[model samples]
Target chain A: MTDFWLAAALCLLLTMALGLVRVMRGPSGGDRILGVQLLGTAGIAVLLLLGAAFDMPALADVALIFALLAAVSVAALTRRRLTREDS
Target chain B: MEMTLQLWSMLCVGAGLFFFAVGTLGLLRLPDLFSRLHALTKADNLGLGLVILGLLPWAGDGFQVLKLTLIWLLVLLGGATGAHLIAKRALRADGEEMLE
Candidate 1:
């Protein structure tokens, strides 16, 4: 079980590294937003893995909060951009 | 005895990781914002969902697993909606030009 989780975590870390490359090289604001979204999702997965590994329930709550916040922030940024363009 | 369970767990995790990798690759190689959003949204959601599924067996109780599932669903919802909104606004702002 531990071995499985560890391997999964390592794979997720590699995935995050790939996404980081996108974040760094993204050509547009929207591309960057996409990268951010990927990061947020990956972060949630990491938190869940940590929770299971460490036997901590609070980490799940933290993951939930992070998801909510990331979503809200992205939406807000989009809306702000739209409004700014109209003005 | 428990080896089968371990194997199953590893498989799920491996699947999740594979999806994550696909998403990252798409993000890197997709030529346009909308296409990139497609890659990001699909891969991230599936990746996280698989991870949660893989970890479900390790959770202690029904409530714990339930909470974890809820988090996964929230992420799915948030991710889809967020991507939609951003893509819409971005397309509108840029007026259909491929971003340079």
Candidate 2:
């Protein structure tokens, strides 16, 4: 079970790395932000899997934090864009 | 019974990971922004939800299970809002009016 959890974590990390390719080459800022969004979700999964493998529930708190931050980051982008358009 | 639970957890987690991979593939290979955004929501909603559901069996306490469910709920709310904001911004930037 430990090995299974670890392997799942590794696979999620690879998914994150692949998401970066989209981030790097995305044609628009929105696309890049989308890539970032993918990273955030995948990162949370990784943290959870690692927490299970290592017997650390604290990591779930960390994952929670990541969730909040991810939401805020995109909102910030939208807010900035709104301000730019307004001014 | 314990073995059965473990197997169920493994199956769900594996399926979740596969969805995650599929979403990434769509993000990389899809032809347009809206299409890619479509892919992303799949990962956010289904992928993450399944993972948390799978981990419920391994949760150490009742509180832990509750916390995990809350985390998934938070992500669900956030992901939906973020996706909308992104699509709206992208649409405005393209000078396209929102579809009714």
Best by lDDT: 2
- Docking verdict class for candidate 2: medium
**How good is the docking of model 1, by CAPRI class?**
medium
The positional error of residue B52 in candidate 2, measured at the CA in angstroms, is: 0.9
In model 1, how large is the Cα lDDT of residue A53?
A: 74
The lDDT for every candidate, in the order shown, is 0.80, 0.89
Superposition error at A39 for model 2 (Å) = 0.6
Off by over 4 Å in 1: A81-87, B94-100
List, residue by residue over B1-100, the lDDT tens digit for candidate 1: 4777667777887788888988889888878888888887998898888888888877889998899888888988898899888777786774543232
**Error in Å for residue A42 of model 2:** 0.5
TM-score of 2: 0.93
**Two-chain complex of model 2, DockQ on C-alpha atoms against the true structure:** 0.52
Clashing pairs in 2: none
Residue B22, candidate 1: alpha-carbon lDDT: 89
**At residue B9, what lDDT does model 2 achieve?**
91
For every candidate, C-alpha RMSD to the true structure in Å: 2.8, 3.5
